[model samples]
Target: MSRSVSRGVVALLLSCALLLTTGACGGGDDKTSASAAEAPTASASFEQQKLAKTRFVANAGLAAGATYQWIVKPYRAGKFKKGADGRTFALVKAGLAGAFTYNRLKAAVNNAKGDPLLSKAVAPLSAGIESLKDLGTKLRKGEAGDADVGAFENIINSVKDAGKSAGAEVVDKVPSASQLGGG
Candidate 1:
């Protein structure tokens, strides 16, 4: 074999071996990984599922509260105390809060996996994450307006209703900027 060809083969073999040992290449029966840790070993209990549902509701409620505090109320009152810059800040703040809430809600849903009742109630809410994300993107770009705000409120209402059906309803709880991790 040529020297270059032999060197290439040797490098490839070494890389494969390293990957197999580290369980990165899925070369063996070893399935251990960080993601595996997140997977439930067994179906969640009813109480556990309810708790997760409650958590999802609370997180979503925070986003709703943040929207009202930073966007809706001010817009309705026609008092953007800080002017355009302040309006921009409110939009960005609400957007980040929504994003954060979506992530937390996702985690809660994952934790409640295998519970059909809770899952059914949470499905629509989870599916709305994309729309929520898009709203946030629009807000940040200063392209969001009354229609976007109305859509956001409708989403929040749907989530609240779902939470109620699942017996996990929670009032809106405004989260701090630090909590949203967007400050």
Candidate 2:
């Protein structure tokens, strides 16, 4: 046999082996594979994620008030743009506001080291705020979709609920502290 013909046969055999290995790796439990394939693609569900991010931010900001607005303003102004994706933009804005509010609350809690309850509440509150920031980054990148959005919404709602509970607890603990008091 000619040397060139032998080399061609060897190359063809190697290609077939590679193809078999790849095919075998892909085959798995049919139900699991089908479900995974059926899941919505990221781009298709981007809007939902944006919505969750927005809602969380708004709720957090509302809970925290003025401080939230002040800290998140720059991010909102620079990162968000108006146009077709208005809803998504709004969600991100709200999330940013919430993050800022949470930051202010954390600072206030830190200052009130004498109050352990406030400090404890602030820790989780700070985590919620951080999550909001991460969500915003995802939104900006257009990476998150419906599933992510739903998850984010749940997280924000939880944060809002927690914030409300914490606020009530703080109020009950220190009824006398006026506007002059730390968060």
Candidate 3:
């Protein structure tokens, strides 16, 4: 198979694995399941709003972690290591992280919509994720530019600040390279 085709397959497989793992790891409580499935209405209870904010913070940390592991750290080191696929694992990880961040953050934003403070805090993040809708494909194609990275970091910082303002402070939790499939 062509390298590009193989890369696509790897990305697809990894994405599927990520979906499966994440889905299987949920709390499985009624409230958690319900919250994950649908956005709460504007009059959602405090518990639901608090849950949404927590989710928002967690996802933001995940995004930052993935980015640091698969993108920024490698770039700073001046070389991207090849994975078992003989392709730069960083690219695949970057692509996956971008998509994952976008999807999860979007869901978190939607869930937080019922709370004015949480909603406003995530507004900039929502807009930022919108601009990164295609980031996965771009990273996979090696077409992503420095501006993309800059924008991503900026968005992360913006969301963390907003979260703190809303009393939902976020902590950076850079994941291990292996955790992100960089190996």
Off by over 4 Å in 3: 1-44, 80-87, 175-183
User: How would you encode candidate 2's per-residue C-alpha lDDT over 99-172 as one tens digit per residue?
Assistant: 33334343333332322443354456555445544553454344545554444445445554554554422111
Candidate 3 lDDT score at position 101? 59
Estimate, for each residue in 74-180, the C-alpha lDDT of model 3 and write its tens digit: 55564433343334556666776666555555655665564579788777667677887787667755677778777777777787787789888878776554434
TM-scores, each model vs. reference: 0.62, 0.32, 0.69
Worst 10 residues of 3 by lDDT: 21-30
Q: Which segments of model 1 are wrong by more than 4 Å?
A: 1-47, 79-85, 108-114
* Full ranking by lDDT: 3, 1, 2
Output the number of the TM-score-best candidate: 3
Candidate 1's residue-wise lDDT over 1-183, tens digit each?
996567656644643343233222121112222334355645434444455555556656776676677666755664433454345445555555445555544454553343466668767666665566566556545576788777777777776776678776758888765555533
Q: How does residue 52 of candidate 2 score in lDDT?
A: 27
**Residue-pair clash count for candidate 3:** 0
Best by lDDT: 3
lDDT score, candidate 3, position 175: 55
- lDDT of model 1, residue 105: 46
